[model samples]
Target: MKKNILSALLVMAFGFANAQGTGSRFGIKAGVNFPNTSSDFHENENLIGYQVGIFSEIKTDERFGIQPELIYSTHKVENKFIKEGIAYNNDVKLSYLNLPILAKYFVTQGLSVQAGPQIGFLMKAEENGINITDHVKTIDLGLSFGLGYNFLQDCSVDLRYNLGLSNPIDFHVGDENYKIKNSLFSLVLGYKL
Candidate 1:
């Protein structure tokens, strides 16, 4: 099953590679992320993260395009809570290989709006200095909304927000069950070659 999926992805990549000669651009991108987790049981610590990736933008017309990206990303959320007048902090750090396929609609020559579905494969998970990979789901589903601006000299910038659609936790804190969902905002700079 994995081999079949890999084969299909290779075919799609080859097709896109062929199309790149005609107005498509490929580039490298890196950025900072503000990662968050939503849970009523804890106070937000708001961890900062990082992402680096490759992207391909295929133009369909002067004002429309499709952009696909593969990114290595890190997400961390820390919570400090007071129970029985004692304060404790718990932090969860996660790593993922994220794929986002975006549809771009240009409002002007250099500016476009983008929206996409993002699939994330969990690479690692840790909570409070302990490995917690076995407790979290390996696949994360998300939606991304963002804006992009292309400049001269094959440079561009993107600002995006990713909202998680799945609850990633499989355990509880004391007696509290968590429905933790991911939220991230990112700003990336890209240069095409």
Candidate 2:
């Protein structure tokens, strides 16, 4: 958690340093998220989530830019487990503070491709009718890829996928090692300021 916060600060510092003599735009963004988890005990199932944030785009050239975002995101997981020929359904909800550093390449006048790495810190977690606060891990690392269309110079829409690279749960229940993976897909509406 501390590491993720420090990394986000460093990135923001770098962005600020590079802001001199560059065209920059700040924007507000809101998005819907589809979240899932992967593990041995349960298969992935899509759950609805959302994100709201602010971002800045610093253009280095006509074809390339750097975008940094600070966002509040919700993530959920739903799965069915089978043990001893019986099935049980479980649901998990997690709230996160997410920061993403994106590199964008303009493919056309109004279209672009963006990819980046995102770091997330867990703010809250709930599972199976219980508050599993201590059982949840705080740090999350992921990669993001997206396609965007700039309808106007200051307005755009994006569809993005976030693939988790680390497990956010320490599932240790009497010598059982069951971990949950965090992944999400999002569609965002953005407007520059």
- Candidate that scores best on TM-score: 1
What tens digits encode model 2's per-residue C-alpha lDDT throughout 99-132? 8889999999879899999888888888876887
Locate the minimum summed-lDDT window of 10 residues in model 2: 170-179
Q: What is the TM-score of each candidate against the true structure?
A: 0.89, 0.87
Q: List the residue pairs that clash in candidate 1.
A: none
lDDT of 2: 0.83
Model 1 lDDT tens row, 105-186: 9999899999999888777899998999888888888999999998986999999999999987755657766678888999
lDDT, model 1: 0.84
